[model samples]
Target: MFPDHTSTHADTAIAPGDDTEHHEGNPRPRAMTSTAEIDSTISHPGSVRINVKGAFIVDSTEQPATPANGNSTVNGSYHEGKDIRLPNHTAVVSHIAVDIGGSLAKLVYFSREAHSTEPGGRLNFHSFETDRIDDCIDFMRHLKDNQLALNGSKPKDLCIMATGGGAFKYHDKIKKALGVDVLREDEMACLIIGLDFFITEIPREVFTYSETEPMQFVEPQADIYPYMLVNIGSGVSILKVSGPKKYERVGGTSLGGGTLWGLLSLLTPANSFDDMLEMAAQGDNAKVDMLVGDIYGTDYNKIGLKSTAIASSFGKVFRMKREAEDEAEDNANVAQDHPQLDQKVHASSNNATSSSQPRGLNDMSSRFSASDVSRSLLYAISNNIGQIAYLHSHIHDLSHIYFGGSFIRGHPQTMNTLSYAIKFWSKGQKQAYFLRHEGYLGAVGAFLNRQPQNWGRRGSFEGDGAALEDRLRARTSEH
Candidate 1:
């Protein structure tokens, strides 16, 4: 949402099927039902396309109902025509890409249609909490009912792709709610794909580090060779990008945004992620987090890792003298309540975790006001991911890193933190990148999976009749 994090450069390829020569009508392959095959019964295009590389989820249901027909717009675009053949059989791609993170469940969908002249079909995107599984399911149903009400579309065909821990946990509810197919992608895979797609697609997508000056572009191609894909969503994961298609998820810690989100929710009165940012913006994390001096008593300056770097976030919560905390609280109250003290503090110009984010961020500003807390959590997760990625990259001798997933979207500070951490850890040897459309990777992958071999690559299309006749002529002559 903000400017790019300062840094540099990236690459990916996703093509389906074998060749450009397609059967007269068999182009977009509807993912065959579990038992069925490509044969006599189904012979039309499907409205789903996903690029496996990024597991990008793209839902394109071109509904033909315009002012000429009857249909309402959904998510700004109209479902043009579900079934051009039957006119009665409503065709729609109502897929849900639910990314259950440690803190929240990011559920995205397409539930309505647009008949207007504006391009890009009317597809809606929405989400809810990870804990509210039932509500998320209900929301999906509402989307389905809305689609069916507008036109009797098949709930069974609704595309449902899930990742993260809850994918397996809440699988049944999703299928039962929509009577559709549920696809499970590895959470790590989804994160990588999502990251790669977003960076390549969205030009302005970037995170900032070092005062936001000379912000780094979310460049996926300008790589040093093989690097790491550090996804800090609900949890944290690291994938070493080796080659165009070669990558290995080295290792990751479960301690990430989920830990931060859960802890903040319980320890403080923060309601939303934004609220947490607001509070952290002013709150003093040093009061809570454990510093290096608390552990070593001196600067262990042999390695650049500082003593003041949070040794254990919130460790001080247990060690602080209760009297000091009480007195500090009294002083803070006196300062704020007394106005004069507040004015003095303001005049001195001291900034804490409250509103303490790197410069050049959007209005959202990093995750909550406890920016120190947020920054600390980000460092813990991103640092771990980056170090692991560096290990894998060194082992495999690869040079590109793409970090993705819903977590990155909600926490740009985390992205910049990860980027800077990776850069610093590598001693300016490696870098990190972020994506714009963070969560659509798997959904787009699912969508592209349905197209014919020649469908994905541009300029490879064969016309319905004339192109077929010319190809047949060439084949017959050769025979």
Candidate 2:
């Protein structure tokens, strides 16, 4: 849960300094031009005018172009060398949208081009920890100020579209900080809309991950209906999406990303979620988890369970602790009965090197390394989510299941576990899909809410979508 009111003292700004260099030509005076003049200008090759709401002006003879590196150079300044590419021409920042979840706040905004043929500008993505709401507000304030300086006047329609629980919780703070109206949209609806845009419009946005072939792109299907969306955030929500803006939250679980995070915070030395993930990556879950082989001495072929399959998460640790406690108790009894022998043993143990001495129950980290604990907990959470998601898909008879939300973070182990769960549960009849920008779905959906409902199918908006797809594909190929 988020606090109703933000703290009086703002958190330190986490954004780095602007290091992007800028080059600008002489500013051209603004003069209104007739539609005929705009038509005639278009007739001439390489000449275009800035068209704003039927008003046209020749800003430059040549159209401004985005750099080949997919970095936007807007208003004489680059986007701090970020990979974000906006429309060719510079425009005002009219609107911003945010999806503030329990853990993270994702933001999406657009800089409309003043002199471009495209209808929609490129979307920029940014996020911050929920605890750092002040920092996020600062970033938004900077963006609004920058736009005000460029256009010399604020757009009357400027507003912040927000979703998630934090929208209502942080509404007053955001409005007071930025002096902009906050519009709250339904959280689930925004997620579906955002996902629909990416899967339908953006090329290579959706993909499948596996151990054999990681990040294999899945082309947008012609009939992408009735699919299951398992959004793993602080909690998990499984929805059955039948069409655009048509979805229902059928099932969910509390054992989600938050579960792993809370457990790791108490059990491991990981200071952050990424740190826990990194620790888990190097860990051997077999050390702390009970496997099928441990229980059966071989694979449970009757039920098709493999030898390496996890029998119980942290199951080995429980048994190990009990055995250690019983041994310690036995040692205490022997020491009470045979004091001389116990003294010799104690002296020998004290004389031995620290590495040679057995780790006690108090030193759980030494007995069961933090890495192994992290790995086991990660598997436990991922496996539980995957199984529940699969069950929902099965109940609805939906074959295509997509996992989204901040929890995945495109981490291989997380994806692999989820994918493997679906495969194991459905006997390879179902597959799990992922997204490149999985975490920003709600933010994007809220951004798109500013546009007309049918914008995706409109001619100009379709053209913009194609352009964005091309840009994203180009960036992907370069990497």
Candidate 3:
């Protein structure tokens, strides 16, 4: 699945349900027999296929083991037990919000403990590939069924709040699978709303990455206006947020996460996005990228270019063409010398793919390892996005530029690259901050749309922003 490339930013509210609530002690859904089958294709790069059957088993015997937090663990996901509950299970309000993109589908729902009337619960997050919509639908159905079975508070009408392009595309499919109406919300509005909520509520949500030092959590700014939100998904969208419900789509780039994934699939054997990022962790981009030193035989001090600075991405591949050709010839010679071994190797490669990927290739380049290609691509994309973000920040006169989206996934190299780019471009006048719940921002924003009024507003929170900042600063130092 890929990101929704359609640029529609209109707010459309289709359906709204009663303020129904949910109580605890419901039957949770379990995976009866879930299995994924990988396609055995070597010619195609992104041709992975997954097949799942009989998912969302609701039997008590199939219930998963709960951790100390009293939250169920499915597929290694551990939700904390901070759920709220209403007394007597009297018409509980259970709201589920979804943000379906091209590549991934994110879900955020609220759950509370029994006999609790407060406006808080365990905000759970789950994600699956957008192509695998059935899997997500199954999970949502399981949650719905579980809620109905335990609470017995069936209402006359029920709908799941959804956002993103996938919401409109899969509207009918989700309705059929979940047996509930899908209320679509505006994608960009939901994203900004979500960012505002977490950055204010969660104590350890936003952090700044300063060079080689450990990440320091940034407290919520009291006058949190005029900040920029740069969400890097399949593509990038830069929103200049001035205040609540007041923002503008200042700029964006077509070259973003999708570009990186597309190029990486062509160069590396990594099938999944995360696997490609892992490869980059152990990679040396210097081997694949032509540096200033490589071009000038020394640092171009007159232009303030460091010797190690990348002159051009993937430029070394062409610059070192002679060596690459020699390596290719050597591999060809080895293959010819052992025809039987070469055939066997090709056969194995055809049948095997990455653990979570779909395609397999025996064509790992002899000139450069997968790690080198991965790192080069990573740097190339991150640096490009960072530079664009910095330029936008300068044009808009914005100081804080927070980067979020599924592409980041807490990747150190990616974050460091963006941080370094901002520092270099702004001359330390600005900093790049990342969110702990980066991928779920849109989904959370959609969920907040269903919550009580003023729930996501700045004035709703009662606290001294400056005092909170000082407290967080002290906490960071102690840690």
Best by TM-score: 2
TM-score, cand. 2 vs. native: 0.71
The numbered model that scores best in lDDT is 2
What's the lDDT of the predicted structure labeled candidate 2?
0.67
Q: Lowest-scoring 10 consecutive residues by lDDT in candidate 3?
A: 46-55
Candidate 3 lDDT by residue in tens digits, 297-369: 9989987789989989999877467555565566667677887776676677655533222121233355688
lDDT of each: 0.48, 0.67, 0.64
TM-score of each: 0.59, 0.71, 0.68
| Residues 355-435 of candidate 1: C-alpha lDDT, one tens digit per residue | 223211222223224555554554555556666666655666555566665455434445556666667766777656554
lDDT, model 1: 0.48
Answer with 1 or 3, whichever has the higher TM-score. 3
Model 1: worst 10 consecutive residues (lDDT sum): 1-10
Score residue 166 of candidate 1 by CA lDDT.
Answer: 77
Error of 1 at 277 (Å): 3.7
